[model samples]
Target: MTPEFGSRRTAIVTGGAKRIGACFVRALAEDGWTLLIHCRESVAEAEAIAAEIGNGARVVAADLATVDGPDRVIAALEGMPPPALLVNSASLFELDSHDDFTAEAWDAHMNANARGPALLSRGFARAVPAGQGALIVNLLDAKLAQPNPDFYSYTISKMAFAGVSELMARVLAPQGIRVNAIAPSVTMVSGPQSRENFAKVHAMNALHRGVDVDDLVRALRFLVASPAITGQTIAVDGGQRFLSLPRDVQFMES
Candidate 1:
């Protein structure tokens, strides 16, 4: 028989302090999922979320950019039941042009966006019972296919993480653990965004609409509830993936 919502089931949401991560935390909490919200520097924000969620959530701070960051997060959950859900929402987004790229910048993106998710998923899989099932939802970017030159390192790292989602799903399926990803396009905001800026971004998509935090939350819920889907990425970008880019100047001129 399936267990109750808040019975023994737990979810670990990395970077669950602010922005998209915090949205996931609140949504899961409302669904009666006990959450371990991990944050790197948003301790006060994390605390606020924990308090807001009351009994359904708690917080843990870990720097996912370091080698031991994932370990520290997993260690914090030692006494609880193995989390049935792992949301790798914690990531680093930085701008790096190819001409000015540095190893340090590349490494930072790889460590946080790619390596951190891979390691956290690994740890969560190990903690689950041999025959029991688990789910991992990785956060990805909508431009994963159309690589943005402006955010060079960030784009590359997210691409690597998308590959990790597929690889993990294939390897862990036999154990009943499913892995999937959600590629959202400008769903959450870090600061005040003017209507003009919003309209400009919205105009780039096929739907002529911008994604909101609720859209991402719905995608997460669908992935968690669907038992047959695995190793796939759902682009919740209002059909932006289908949009085509203009040809180069020479081609256009021809």
Candidate 2:
């Protein structure tokens, strides 16, 4: 059934053209949210998603790494009713060990994961109307909790963004805007060794499992509607965060 525009809410979810972001968009679409889906390069996928959602849904292309990109996205919704929600789901995850990390790599990580969301949150608060109170959900990672030595820059960047989530929550609350986050452990995506990594990561979870995208979508919906909850980072990590491994143990021995 085509969603009713009048009853529909609207949300702008960055990096929402595919994967976990797409899952959230689908859930929100089903819940009657007309989406402003954002992507940096996935135009075809974004269009496909727009077609699928079909409830006055639209797509915007914005590079989170550029200053102009955030402004362009915010401008696209100008004079329209303020979106009821914003999901800063766009991010860059790259593996850079400390010794090999370049200035370019560090800037990319900080800009995409940390600065982009902060800029968007600033825009959302400044633009969204009061009494209508907007919700913002930033998709963080469980890697922030247990820093991966290999993925150094990505983990550090997310850790900074996670802190920004809390700051936004406290500062935005006075304006009736709620900001929160969901940190996921292992989201099954693909590559040659992806399945092996997925299995290893899934086993790290106390539940001995990995979560499907649907699980994250559920968490997003709850946070969106839950006015009382803000500034918190919920670990949708299948209890993986609680598993304390012995750091001193050598990987070769294990």
Candidate 2: list runs displaced more than 4 Å. 1-6, 190-193, 245-254
Q: What value does the lDDT take at residue 64 in candidate 1?
A: 86
Q: Candidate 2's residue-wise lDDT over 98-168, tens digit each?
A: 78998899899999999988998898777776566678899998756665565668777888999899999
lDDT of 1 by residue, 1-254 (tens): 13322266789999899889999999988887788999999999999998999765778898888889888888878666557899999888766678898999999999999998898889888887777678899999887755547667887899899889899999999988999999987665322444555545654567877789899999999988888889999988887666643421111111
Worst 10 residues of 2 by lDDT: 245-254
Most accurate candidate by lDDT: 1
Error of 2 at 81 (Å): 3.9
Q: What lDDT, from 0 to 1, does candidate 1 have?
A: 0.81
| True-vs-predicted CA distance for residue 249, candidate 1, Å | 19
- What is candidate 1's CA lDDT for residue 50? 89
Candidate 1 wrong stretches, greater than 4 Å = 1-6, 190-196, 245-254
